[model samples]
Target: MNELLSTEEKRAVIELLYQLADDDFIISYRGSEWLGLAPHIEEDVAFSSISQDTMGHAAMYYQLLEELGEKDRDYLSHARKSNERKNAVLLELVNGEGHYLHEPRYDWAFTVVRHYYYSQAKKVKIESLKQSSYPPLAAAAVKISMELHYHLMHWTVWFTQLLNAGGEAKKRMLKAIAKVEAEFEDVLSLGPLSKEIVKAQLIEEESRLLLSFHANINAVFNDLSIPYKGEFTSLSGRGRFGEHTEDLSEALNTLGEVYHSDPGAVW
Candidate 1:
């Protein structure tokens, strides 16, 4: 009985849902690349678990879109071109040089920093969405929030351990942090429908969410006796506005390999 939304409200909701679903979809793919390749077996399992949970969250959002009379969840998740996607620019970047199946030289420090920053931001967004004007979205947020506790903890543990380890670990982490933060503005963005999304109360304003994220991460940094400028730049184009790097195109090509071969068994 939650079908009292106007056309505009529904459009905004759909767009926001696409952003949510697309962000998780791309990053979970990135996370999956680390399978069997994490620093150790235990971490291999843990990271795999997190990636699975994240993909499930993405499915939930796409299913919500389906309920709103959109395309099938399969097509939504698998068939969209990169520019049609609404994910943040940061999530679409490759893991590192070389293919995973080949001589993969992935950067663990970058992985830790990227996931840590993303986890914190996701936590903030989900908490806000729990109060979303759209009931289905709010409920989805509630369910997703339960699992995010572990997600945040896992990434935070890695971030903290690397920073405290000092020397090379710390240096690499600092570099990763800078790289991740440089593109974080788009991650926090609500896409081209920001005002409309905020107008519909699908989530809180980006400014407020940004403050919460800064405070949360700054406190974590302070605990480690590290200085955080909390600064971000628009050095990259807005993925939300259908702008993206070739990295996303490459990712889509790999991800859609099976789907293109046979959409029926895209799993």
Candidate 2:
């Protein structure tokens, strides 16, 4: 029989899983809303695939949570309180000032940079999880890591193409990079439980993992002849500390509406 997680291990595992699940869930929700509004038809198709992958990753995380005795995956996902959510603010932010439905002047460059940076971070985390001592999670990580190939490739292409496109696209891309850099430390952080998770061997050391992340981004920028400045900006507050934006509240309202209506009602 497989070894079950100890009590402390279970708590640690749940913390990590909730972060993973909620981050993907909220981001994918926004991505889904953007389906028909993308700049180009071909790009829209490609973008939808990314949203689907994110949702799929969320589902995988939810399944793991279910095995750990959370409410049914759907209920836990859709009915959770705003404070209960563990996703970063960046993942929950709205696409733009206006609603996604009408007259929303979404910027393609921001989308590319945001998705590219986040996807790369997700890949790094998943890679670390593949070696997690928790058997079920490690197995799931292996499966999730497989699909990242397309995701990383797709975002890389977009990141490079638009950066090279020049003009407005380049301006937009640069702005997006600035926005992403502002909040990046949050993504790299594992929150207050970082030390515990590291001790549990649930993932690799944060510093080492972050180094790998920087190396990957540096390589990409170098290939593009973009000067690789090690500096990253963070105009926004630290999201890993549970601080959030109004966008997160709005997202929780929509995502949890159906689930909150009848969290106890069997679906």
Taken over the whole model, the C-alpha lDDT of each candidate is 0.92, 0.81
Query: 10-74, model 2: which lDDT tens digit per residue?
Result: 78888888888988888899888788898889979988988998899899899988888888788
The collision pairs in model 1 are none
TM per model? 0.97, 0.93
TM-score of 1: 0.97
Tens digit of lDDT per residue, candidate 1, span 103-126?
Answer: 999999999998999999999999
In model 2, the worst 10-residue window by lDDT is 232-241
RMSD from true fold, candidate 2: 1.8
How high is the lDDT of residue 59 in model 2? 94
The candidate that achieves the highest TM-score relative to the unseen native structure:
1
Off by over 4 Å in 2: 1-3, 233-235, 264-267
lDDT of candidate 1 at residue 78, scale 0 to 100: 86
